[model samples]
Target: MNTFGMWRLARKYDKFPTPEEKPYSPFNRQEPQEVFDGTQVYSWAAGTAEFAHRGAVLLRPLPEDPAPGRWLGYKDTVRGPALDWHTDLGVIRLVHCGDSKAATDVASAITSNGNKDGVVTVCALYGDMGFHGPALVAADTAHPGIEYEASWGDVAALVGQVLPWWPDLLRLPSVIREWKPDAQAAVVEVPANDNEKILCRAAANDVFDVTSRVAATDMANSIRNNQVDHTSHEIEIFCKDGYSETPNQVVAGAVPDTSHHPLPCDGDREALKAGWHKLALHTHPDAVAALEVAVGREPNLLPFGAVTEIPVRPGTISDRWTQRLTMCDPTAAHAVLAQDDKAEAFFIGPLTDMPVLRTPGDDGKQVWRFYAPLSLPAGGPELASVVLHHTLWVITSDGHVHPAPCTPTEHLWWGDGWGDRASEAAAVVDQLLDDLGATVDLHEHWNAPKGLTALFNEEHKKGAELTRAALLHARMTPPRTR
Candidate 1:
């Protein structure tokens, strides 16, 4: 057909004549300015102001009667409530939506047409402008008046300087040091007309630029005022290279380079001799307490457990990797252990974190030796490796814990792939023990007593050996090749 004829023919059977829907187009959209009123943007701060840390604190009107709330969502080991996964992720996606659509984006919506009977209020520890997730209400019965809030990291009782609201909301809640309201105020600046571009740039990238600057300013002031005392905890560090008296902060940041520091308990050992460190935290119970306060129980790979006498609290001593090897107030006391008659000292931190000691051999010359459990012919693939830690500590009255290089008993590492090849791995361990016995004496204070040691005595070694076995198996296993 001709062009005009085809057009007419196609038009004759079109659904448009019967009023069909048309496709959407950009022209169909309306101006967003229709309901946007700057004056209508009444000052809205999410939570009540219990306290402020200068710019860190956005002063909000206090609630008439703030209700007392309990801390929740914390692991039993941690002192405070945990921060939520989203807070850790630091994701922020703002949307322009009304009450109905708002629920889709925000876990807890703060605005209501002003009928305050729905959601109960709570003071959260650390959150972005105190905005918790959507109110804890059922979808069908949820009310607009009640704002939703569920924060993980903030324990209500925790009090510290203000933290920045950012991609990730991290709060440092310790005892509040010197208040730096003046310092915080000094850094607060009104963005100049020329600084619009700078503000825009920061907005594009750093979610918490202003808050960061404010925090930095406050922190600087604290330092200048001598408030942030960078006190070092006295410790005797031992490692393969050498032993030295260093601060806790220095070694806390050491790379957990397992290759260089394969903690006897953490991985396999082929060479009977290994290099490790002894961090002399034995004398500093206050340092220990500071460490516990600083760590507050994050995820730990291995925790060496023991039951000690002081107050007799049974707990695990392990590396709190997240504390980043920090030092806290020496005055901050922690519960220390003291046996009925014996010197009670427990190994603290991760096995890999301590300093390596120079062990003395029976040969008299300086030796690189680790006294570990001797695995005799025993059943199970489990006994194929050595334990993690082999030393117990004794704190002196004078607060000086000299590193005593002790070998203690430990098993030898044999390759895996046998379920009950006790004979194979055990024989290897026996031979190692015989060699060490001939070369080094076990009766010496450096080594633990021979034969099957007590459960408490071999506990650390057992844990270490198991971890070593697992790690050894992983290392020994050949990777799949295409």
Candidate 2:
């Protein structure tokens, strides 16, 4: 005769021998339909089977050292994705509902056993699954889920204790064999695509402390939430779609603002002979007026011009090196398609306060020591149509046009990149960017430039890598309902 009660384990285990002391549910779990897996046992009753049911419960009792007290209880099992990977893999799960960070803590604890004697790997879910199955299962109301797999040796580690009456769940159609390739003189490794990632920042818990899985719903909600009301603390978003947040609006996959970037030093040349993208100097009103006809410049941001050589600095070529910073007449900016050379190619950028000035000790500064670049607008017609999208491009020069991409905000359009000129322009832009610590592509060929692949610093690199993660999040996260 068998009796049923609360079969409390001193600690967590794989199975038991008889009818569970605690029996409230029924033995109804059918094994995975695809395969007759024998490794797993029953879900509710104390029995092993060629296949395990869906609601398989497992025990993970508290340890003695920490004195879990009332917190220690039966650990629930996570089933394979009910719908698809949209839920989670069919790996083992361990749910804990303790506090706000309870799920996170439990995930960490479970991860500790990964690759252990009986564990294979552990991971957080792609999204938080709803609870309609059973209690004591490891899960959150609307948080992330944890996924872990048992070693082949213990593939049935999630099955309840194997009782004498339990059917054999270990005779699976699948075989768990070790993969051992013969030693090679040189083993080749395959490369994984670096573009994969989540596009949203973690607004909540961090399961892996690396990249948190968010649902598509959460991502759209996050975008709208950021628009309606910004949060106090939120991680930065990756711009796989070329996202740029402006003062008035958030631009996604649009043109970057180039009306005017901040310029200080009041165009003071002496103080900017090396690098002073940081030194603030008021921008001269005359310079602003000259640039206004072509581009937009920030009202503030100007302490003084760092390259003070007349608001319209002229470009000069010395010893095959060009120190070009000339203020061409706004009328020369453009004409009717056939009026002139079309003057359509524009490459806008910041004029280094210390153009042509080389810091003797600075290694990166050597290139500019020889060639001074004539920065131009980034817009206008081009040979190879490459770069990200921005705003509407109206003819801003020729009396009807304003100096864009090249305004005080961005300097006005000038500079030719036909032959060596383009290469020269590239060098100038590079040095300026290096000095200013500006990350993002000066080339602007790829609107959605992959993260740090084009960046130089750690912060920028980290951000780019996170974009892959964010892309994942954006794709996976669902739209918020309420």
Candidate 3:
């Protein structure tokens, strides 16, 4: 359908019949014109005001207090009456309906009306005014086919300044911002040969020509303002390809990238071996905080469960993968055993070369080399592969965080299968220990260690008392995957 000179934002009502049923038309609809005797079309100031953005005076009366009343077939509190402003070109009306369904039905009936020559009925669906589909349905009829469509916001953008009535209705709780006032305020006269007449004529013409470039320009501006930016505030970056005092860093935004930076425990061996920069000695709190936010937890420089004198609180370190790497390995006792007797001295050193480190990059740039626990062969697959992945984080002196790279692995892709295998292996170990209780209980004797001769004599008696042939026959087998 072509652009029309008249427009109306109306509500659907069940009492109202379609044109086929009742043959109704707003042009011929009659109302008591005696009420609008002394009331003037109120003009509100723009910029946070309801309408009148471009200093244009509103042609409609200010909405009165919404009270309990009935409109069409629905019973509810009502605002102002349905009001219409007529111009030489056409007329625009605001017909407040009882509910959203009534508003939609009224709009559909009007759009589907055969005699609606210079009329455009818009169904103002506010809830879904941001999307194109809903906007189209709101602007067009929901009958056999859609005639015109635009979201309520888009319609507001296209003619909000010129046709301020509907936008004003949108601010209220009612579906149809009604048009006609009470009987005392019904017979509203035309603008008395002033700028208001010129403005009303212009609004009528604009609403008529709404299917033109003017609407297009407004929609373009709205679309530009509604675009989404997916940039993250804090990200883990990586070292650049070449070296410099201020080496350039590459963003790892969801990309597959690896870091060659040295770990805190490995000293400079891994760095030298990988030909990357040495670990930086200091930590930047801001950078650490950013890394924590990106990784969802604070990075532990030392392995978990490592005995320390510093009175570390339990659950302070939540990274289970790093914890298991050190906790499950017997040789990792060095991390727990203190070498000095100082009050603050604890064996807090990293057991494996897996803890994250702050390493110096080219120029004054520092990179956080985060080593996640991949696999601890010494602790066996169950403990070693607890966290079979690593992430890299790089921080520069300028304090900007780069997005971290995500490198996918088989264990991460199919974790459930790996977890089941690990659980089965652990269960087997538990079963073996339970069956060989007395034989394996020798380690418990160390709490009160006797002399070597006494330990040997006790071991000899226990061994002789146990059935050697039966023990040799009993075997523990790990689960095998086909």
Candidate 4:
């Protein structure tokens, strides 16, 4: 039967009559009355009820250590060993309230084997025995005592004994698997461009580290296989669009003859000769100035005034003074003008300080002349043009004017190619502008005779004002937002 039915049976038989029948309430009032002490019986019944309802129950020992103990009892016929029960309360009892047949069989086995001992039972005036279900059945080994019908309440008392070894059994194997490291390779994609070319070149030369070798090789192969074909195809498609192949080397065109003769030198002849030879080889547009310097005498070889007989300094050359005249008309006039011994020599002037002007005489008048500075400008005119965004004008003594060339506008397929062209143009423009600006300033201040001094000063003032205005305008303009 179920646990509830057993509980109902226990309740019915365990009750007593009310106050009207005995003139007192047995549970709530005092009276001279007879009573039966069934605390152990009730305890067993309560345990049985618990066991029958719950299949298993945890048994916590005194010290709370999860260890095995001695068997008290089990559901009679399950054929398993009787569970061991241990607790700080000395010894505890477990009553199994399992199936009735199983309980009876267990009782018979324990009784037949004569293993039952230290067991007890209780009896009362009863008809139903207040037991409605099978529970722990203890066999009488010492004596055949009154047979008590166990209830579901008795099974609960035996739960600890029924599963005492559960904790130990559960802790058997605690091995866990270890994690393995990931070993997958990573992939990288290379973009088609000049950078790819550079990378490939670096890889070919083994300039990159070993870790990067694989990536570099892949990029190189990709460039060789795909980019090569693609570049060729693009070149073919753009061929008809006026796309010209850039020349690897630019040829120097027929430049004007602006070479200078060295000045007459009063220094050691051998040293002067060697200096002139070296200067001539390195100098452009001023070979004449160098020649005159090697001669060790004033260039005014003409029988003129005291200026012609002026004694040259120990290491000074005559052309050094004469070359200053070149700036007056750098395009055509070839004449020595006044000289400034304190002139700050820069770029190409260490060998010869003065620049002579070569004039082209036309119609019995010097109209065109080319100015050659003994020293090149500190920062060349090419760089100045890039910074200033202004064209340089070269004026000759014979009234000839030449403007520095502009950069060519051409599309380049690669950034390196474009940068190369820009750098080259910038350098050329810087050189040209430096030379022109120096020449113009030198001619205005140091050339033109004293009679033209006022006119030259006025022109210089105007040029200075214009330069200031341009600079101010640049400073005031708002920067491009983009």
Residue 400 lDDT in model 3? 21
- Candidate numbers sorted by lDDT from highest down: 4, 3, 1, 2
Q: How does candidate 4 score on lDDT?
A: 0.28
TM-score of 2: 0.20
Clashes of 2: 104
Each prediction's total of clashing residue pairs, residues at least 3 apart in sequence or on different chains, is: 39, 104, 37, 91
lDDT per model, in order? 0.23, 0.22, 0.25, 0.28
What is every candidate's alpha-carbon RMSD to the true fold? 25.2, 25.8, 27.5, 42.5
RMSD of 4: 42.5
Residues 1-482, candidate 4: write the lDDT tens digits: 22344445456654421122233655776655433223333324334534322211221112333343344433222333232234332222332223333323444455566544433221111112123221234322222232344332233233222221111111111100111112121111213355445444544544334433333344345444443344334323322222135211111111111122121223344443343333323323233332233222322211111111122222233333333332322210122222222122121122223232222233333222222232233332322211111122233233322332222221101112322322322233223433533322221222223222221122132112123233233334533433
Which ranges of candidate 2 are over 4 A from the true structure? 1-50, 53-366, 369-482
Q: For candidate 1, write residues 42-122 as lDDT tens digits.
A: 111122122221101112233344343321221111222212111111212211112332322232332232313222222
Task: Name the regions of candidate 1 deviating beyond 4 angstroms.
Answer: 1-165, 169-282, 290-431, 437-482
Better of 3 and 4 by lDDT: 4
